[model samples]
Target: MFDWNDIRFFLELCRKGRLTEVAKALKVDHTTVSRRILSLEKQLDAKLFESTTRGYVLTQAGERLLPHAEAMESASATIQDHVGGENRNLTGVVRLGVPEGFGSQFLSKDMPSFQALHPEIELEFVANDRFVSLSKREADLSITLERPRSGRLISKKLTDYSLRLYASRDYLAKHPPIKTVEDLKDHNFISYIDELVPDPQMLYLSEFVASPNVTLKSSSIVFQFQATVAGAGISIMHCFVADEHPDLVCLLPEEIEVNRTFWLNTPEDIHDLARIKAVTQFLTELVDRQKKKLLGVLE
Candidate 1:
């Protein structure tokens, strides 16, 4: 029989797709990870992964074995939770893929509180604009712009948030008064590069002005926000983030509002795991408590 311990290495390799990353996660040497996989393959008499320029791609046998290994992992976790008395102290690494703005500007501030509450849980954030694949185990859970239409995933609407055009007090002081959307055409704007935007929902600038005088373009919302705060130009920004900066003024809030939703998704197989559940609960509560701010309901 193959050593069950070797299955952990196999699963981690499948998720991380790199011996070095799997080794770091498993706290073993990369050579040890390779040796474990070699041993596992020999015992099973199967080729599991193929190495290519893009890293490890699973072979047909590895793909076939994936669900079974995941089942074993789930069962092992359940046993630890109930039989090993680890339920009382949830301890595991849960990597969450989130949009850069939400992860860095919003959720990052509250992470300390979560750490205080669940001291044993190791939370890692993959903050970026690109979509992460839960099927590939890119992340344990994700906060995405749209609900995934297909996958072995469970998804729910996390929250509906608002974005509005904002300008710095310094910029407004120097420029012409903007009473309507048409007036925006003459003013400088900071926006995402049109070709580089990952999703249609992120194309907020075009909704208001047909031809904006875009002075700077960046792939990062945080960068755009910083530029806007420096009196660089007007840019559509999340109210939750922009409102926090007193110097940044929301312009034409009623005439130029863009709404978007955040979806929380986790693989169905691991959705019930204590660590995953804890993180999801924390996100749900966090969004719920911040509804007013997220929705741009000024108090």
Candidate 2:
């Protein structure tokens, strides 16, 4: 008979790609993950991973076990949802990965309300633009600019937004007149400070700007916007974020525009928890309510 715990550990290892990464996701120690993997491999009598400094690579047996484990995950979720009866007051944590822009511009302001209404639930908002692997349980929910790779997950197009290049009104005053995209080459650029480029929006630079000379690199869009507003440099920001900030003005009104989509992503097993279901429903509703606000960001 197969030990269910072994399967669970194997599933986690396959999804996460490394004992270290899995340990961090499970909030346990690397040694624990290593022990679990070794135990599972020993029981199955198969090599499941090829360890390296970067991470673990799944072996053939590990790959073969993936679909079965995912099916089990789906089954588990279904059973839980059935037993929970779709209750609204869900207790437990719902880890949320939000782009820094949305976290600051919209979600943060309304989060208190979500907390007040659902006191039993704790919201873990991990601010990152990088698309963390949902299959690995990096987060329970994620809001991203582009659609993620399809798998055992449920996703929705939350909203369509845009990015507009802008600078502090005072900085614009100092900069040359912006009439075309070519003019932007002369100005200092502010960009998200990481090489982990999963965001399709950032990839636009590859096609548009042949050589981008970023003056400031920040991990947070809010901070990037702040720096731009303080005359640090010019940046392309979600129009909604730049619109209300009184200090910034759109540069080259017609040249710098991005048509982007906001997608809400979650694991397929999300429906199993009553609390997750409530947040999922509320999140869908929340995005629907602000359709215009998101659409206005790029225009």
Candidate 3:
């Protein structure tokens, strides 16, 4: 039987199309790579490669076995990446992406605790409404409301949150009471400017107001809530976040409701790393603890 490790070295050489390049990328001596290829041919009783002026050319036997060898290499590498990171202490920078609203309300409060637990690990947060591409390493992990469409990343649904209309108590009293979605049309509304985003709640709000009537527009949900509190107008916000401020009151306690989801995403192939595993587990636990606040937002 052919040695699979030897087959891997052969496959790498084929992929790189040069012995020196493979050696450099793999951080091995060039001779070591050459020796592995030679050893592979002898074990298989096959002339697998020809040394050419350009580099190594695959023989007929090598060409036949190339696909199988590459597949094996991929499978083995995936297994190793996961098992290899086990029992390793997590250290280094972990890039995390979050929505500005969540970053300010939830994550910011727990960062000191998360850092305290893993003091060796450094956190880098990028807060925005735009989704970052995990395929490009824009972030190691992301907290998002949308279940990512990219097949290159894995998403775990953490929780669903409800957004309820809120306004300053004074504003609610001065303006006509909003008992139904249609009542919002008579009153000014504040929301994110983009009328194109496919928000389930936003779609339902169309019955109440024209899409363009978003007089006060901002991408940040925190800013939207701040506008509402300052009597700028009525806006929908996550109940957990809204409840945090005593000044804002739910505009229509029973009628104003839109459910939103939260997701945790990581690179699809990162299931094996020790640091990634620890961070993922910690985040899962952290969100689970707030299940009540996240899921049950009333009043």
| lDDT of model number 3 | 0.74
**lDDT string, candidate 3, 193-285, tens digits:** 565443434443554456525678776677888888898887877777887788888766666577788888987565455567767887788
lDDT of 1 by residue, 1-299 (tens): 99999999999999888999999988999999999999999999999999987778899999998989988987887777657864368887999999999999999999999999899999989996778988877888999999999998999999999999899999999999999988987899998888899887798888889988888999999899899999999999999999989999999988999999999999987888888899999999999999999998999
Question: Cα RMSD to native, each candidate?
Answer: 1.8, 3.9, 8.7
- Quote model 1's TM-score: 0.93
Q: Worst 10-residue stretch by lDDT in candidate 2? A: 197-206
Q: lDDT of all predictions, in order shown?
A: 0.91, 0.76, 0.74
Off by over 4 Å in 3: 1-89, 195-204, 207-213
* Deviation in Å, model 3, residue 280 alpha carbon: 1.3
Off by over 4 Å in 2: 16-39, 42-56, 84-88, 176-187, 192-197, 203-220, 252-256, 271-273, 297-299
Superposed by TM-score, candidate 2 places the C-alpha of residue 148 at a distance from the truth, in angstroms, of: 3.3
